[model samples]
Target: MKTPPPSELVAEWPLPPLASLGSTVRAIGIQRELRRHLPWKMRGFLRVDGNQAVLHLPIEEKEAFSAASAKIATAIEEISAYPVLPSEVEDILGISSRERHKWMKQSRLKSAGTRTVKMRGRAKAVTFHVFDAQHIEDILDRDLPTIWRQEDAAMSAENRKRAAAKRRQTRTQARSQSGCAGSADDASGSKLEGWDVFAAEGLLRAPRK
Candidate 1:
């Protein structure tokens, strides 16, 4: 039940592909018959049960069913070009989730003010959200691997900076607690043997459990 805003007005109505029908002579013939009785003007739901085609009328009709159905047929014809629900954008644009989000945040995946739809399979409706189809096509045309790699590098760098800062804070606190200025006995320097080149960068050893 996707009711356009009142201000938007149901200036047009369209029909969806007969989802419940199989692609067969009997099925397609039945669909063709059902289309005849469809209330296509303002808004209506078309349901076909066996040979019966039921056109569920709108709550309130401002026009004749025949007039509405004519408008609906036109609208339904135009719907053939629209992309209602696109599966994994990765498939359409050849990008990953992180890359997609990165581009979206940068307004590269879709132009500014662009929208992508949110579709409901169970409800059989497409929400107002819709992405720029041209943007997606450009993304597919451009090589986004480099951009994705750059994003990964920046993320890694940020993580490294945070880790280093945490380490520096830990070291500073440990030194303060030890109450030692140039305490040659900096316990963290390394576990040393009496006569050893303690001068060298401490051994890269695994930490004890």
Candidate 2:
């Protein structure tokens, strides 16, 4: 029924600059990745401090901390290997959800691959596109998202213009067809007008038997 002792073992690792890309969420992702490499029970002991993750454990848990520290160091070394997540892509690229979706769909923002992870409170796992760190960096460096957005806007505008032209052409054709039909009907009516005269002349009547 006593409080646990203070943590005496400590270690820290700076987050990878490319992985974090000055995004807090991205940094948190790196921290989460570090935690994943450690034992589940000890995961909470690791936390983000400024731009790095620090691990703290009690003196009695020194051996466990040592092992966790090694894992964290290894994980940090390979932090760039972690896939750039969808949210991270948005933040790092300063793009909207729609932009991200559009570019990804068009392969402008090419996905290195996909990653599946279970949501914290959900029974189902969600799968999404992940980008390579270098790929993201390249896109950011070239400001490709802005270019993609401009291209998308132009495409949408062109599509709308084409659609409008198609609609106009369809209407014109419909009107032309209607005019022809009306002319035909008028001509037929005019021809029928002679039928009365022919009937009066008995031409349209059967010969008297």
What lDDT is obtained when candidate 1 is compared to the true structure?
Answer: 0.50
Q: Show where candidate 1 strays beyond 4 Å.
A: 1-88, 111-129, 180-209
Best by TM-score: 2
Residue pairs in steric clash, candidate 1?
A: 40-68, 41-68, 115-130, 115-131, 116-129, 116-130, 116-131, 117-129, 117-130
Model 2 agreement with the true structure over 36-134: per-residue lDDT tens digits: 888889999999777788999988997898888888888889988889899998888898888888777877889888878799999999999888998
Q: Clashes in each model (backbone N, CA, C under 3 Å)?
A: 9, 0
Residue 137 lDDT, candidate 1, scale 0-100: 44
Q: Assess the local accuracy of residue 195 in candidate 1 as a C-alpha lDDT between 0 and 100.
A: 28
- lDDT value for candidate 2? 0.86
List, residue by residue over 71-183, the lDDT tens digit for candidate 1.
44654454333331233355554556666667667666653343343565655544332444444445555766567678879999999999999999999999897776546
Ten-residue stretch with the least lDDT total in model 2: 189-198
